[model samples]
Target: MSTPFPSDETAKETPASVSKPIKSAENASLVDSSVALGFPEGGFTAWGTVLGACLIQFCGFGYTSAYGVFQDFYTQTYLTNSTPSAIAWIGSVNAFLVLSVGVVSGRMVDRGAFYPLMKIGCLLQCLFLFILSLAKPDGYYQIFLSQGVGFGIAIGLTNIPSIAIVSHHFQRCRAVAMGIVVAGSSLGAILHPVILNNLINRRLGFANGVRASATLNSGLLFIANLLMRTRIPPQLNAVSYTRILKNSSRDGAYICACVAMTAFEFGYFFEVFYLQLDSTLHGLSEGFSFYSLTILSFGSFIGRLTAGVVSAYVGIPNTVVGSLLISSAVIFAMIGLQSAVSVAVIAASYGLFSGNFIALMGPLVSYLTPENSHIGARMGIMFAISSVGSLLGAPICGAFLTSHYIWWKAAVFAGSVATGGCIALVFMQVILKMRQKASSVCSKEAGV
Candidate 1:
């Protein structure tokens, strides 16, 4: 919450180019207000923004988490002729856009476009869900276009801004607050699969089930629109995308974190998309497979809540690194899961660790941000870059799985990729510590 800029004396010593971002309207306002009065941290508007963000996460990423249910359903009945790899593209693309399109939306939020983006995103999300419900049982392209592309874009527009807006209201408790917000996705993931599973497979049928969800999402998004308010005004003269990219590329810690995120995402969804299918293939009861997603999401809810509280003590980077390591181990353990109890344990464990990554991602980006104004842009770029992994990971995992459904190869591939991510995060953390140490030594030598 301190001024995002150096003192005028310090500024004189700093190069003009180095201080350029400070002049931007967004950054300037942040510098002025924070220097004069600090963040609210917790108040009605602030908590309301958090509440709104939670709903946004619930509608956006939370619902996206339930795509595995859709994946299982489509593979078994709807898209019967499609290969698993082909079917996975639907979920991959949905996840990809959910993260990728943040580049545009995040930047827009920085420029004070949150309300417009949120409104349009909410409307688009509902519209697309309705369209998705209209698709025929065998209509692969229709489903792909409606649910995959349209819904993804809608959520992408909402997700990043909902996250970025929190920085406007809270700083000290940002991690915990964002953790609660991200946990909304876990809540959605928990409930949505149950709703979709029962409605589509048990009672209402696919189209009506989707319609029911769409109707529910519409109400939730509408409430979010009303409750969430941005405290920071837009930066009319925000930095250019090229400059944001150029600056981000030069930050070793940022680059390393982004790489870690990409690698983490590459392996993150195998369990989410494949758990039910795996359970069914292993001769588990339909009832168990149907609720496996719910169990995983329930673990995620606990994990996300735990992450914020834990990160307060361990630090965000350290917590993230630890989570990545455990998640990779869980993924590796999936090689030959057969017993229902064993599979259940692994699913829950994976969900717990993986949920940490989601909860901490925004805080991590905020920690790395050079200025408050860059929060949106930096998060956008990071998510956009990492989205490539989300885009490709599932289908690649599916391809690794053969016609005979050899699960170990995909497990190896996913776990190994996640391990690579853990290493990157470890490296990033070390670099951050070294920087902090060097800065501390300089401060001491300068004698304040």
Candidate 2:
């Protein structure tokens, strides 16, 4: 981050408006230029933020991933009176708010409210978890409020910093950094469900299990809150947020990519929430059912890291297209899956593809953005726009499940919609590449 100004020669050669974007590539090269940015990239402090981001993301997304176990338990027992669709609303609302509330969080980030916002998020997340622990016996509304809305808002609040801090620190290794950060969520997905499953089965029981997780996450969140720092703080009031929104409209490929994100999210959580239930229904033993989710999470962990490495070489859009195609194929293949072993294998494949998809999102957004003028606003808008699918994806899947009493209907919905998403993504990639090629030809003609 050099000052958002062009040198005199460049200014003379290009219009002021054009100069800003001309430096975008150089500015992103936050590599070993300590004078431009306040700190050098890949330092101890930068890596510290990466670690913190990983912890925060792990807790935030881990909670979402672990909800499948909770969904199964509640439907079969505590919230048994509620329909599957209704009960699924808890996680849906959670995912919805986690994404939709990002507008406010993004603003807070631009205003340099990182620590305070994250602190609030930490408290609220832990408090809501404790509330959920107490509310299980009280009924659906209570669980919805605590685990869904409250916890979601909390995660949303903290999520800005978790994502933003990476940009503040790394540029050269950004994809790799983000991959590592997201892998935290994968790790959490594995640990939380396993922890909860053991506790619910032979250990502490449901109430204590939820409480234990809350306690554990409280500690982790606290550490992240301490270690995650916003490097090169944003200048408040500098970004014209409204203007950025308007500029975004000019980028058709970006808009199409966002749409693809929304569609993909529509089917994103289907297996995450249903695999264990499917296992149980298909007559797999209880312990194995829980372990299946762990397997998926583990596979996802590998996928995230591998995607990071691959995307670094292959480019984000290409990597995304590849992953989306694979994930779509896996989802469609689930329609006939019956045996626990087969389902488990499919789960791992889905995990690899979907994890890669998630891992590449940050890089994809970075590529689509023409300038880095308002990263926070861009992230918030993209998240809010894409959140609708997450809001309803699980509940709709639950409807398919409840209606059919089998996996076929749910599989159909998730798989078909996921394929639609892949098509949209492919079109987006084409549009983006075309735009880039046209820009390249224009630049060559100009011969600066």
RMSD of each: 6.3, 6.9
Q: For residues 1-448, could you state the per-residue lDDT of candidate 2 as single tens digits?
A: 0001100111112223322221332233242212223224588778889899889988997778888898778877788788778878898888888877767776666556777788898999999988888885538899999989999999888765676667666665665676667677788888988888887755887789888888999999988877886644344234565797898888787787777777788777787777787777778788888888888888787787787689878888889888888887887777777787787888899888888887677667767776655544665677787788888888998888783466778888988888887888878878877887999999999996
Candidate 1 per-residue lDDT over residues 1-448, each given as its tens digit = 0001101111112233333223443444444222223467899988999999889888888888888888888888899888888888999999998877777787677556778899999999999999999999789999999999999999888887787677676666765676667667778889888888999999999999999989999999999999997654455465666887899988989998888888888777888888888888899988889889888888877787787789999989889899999999999998978988978898899888887876788778888886765665676677778888888888999899855689999999999999999889888988999999999999999996
Candidate 2: clashing residue pairs, number = 0
Worst 10 residues of 2 by lDDT: 1-10
Q: Please name the candidate that would achieve the greatest TM-score relative to the true structure.
A: 2
* Model 2: lDDT to the true structure: 0.74
Report the alpha-carbon TM-score of model 1 versus the true structure.
Answer: 0.85
Reference-based lDDT, each prediction: 0.80, 0.74
lDDT of 1: 0.80
Candidate with top lDDT is 1
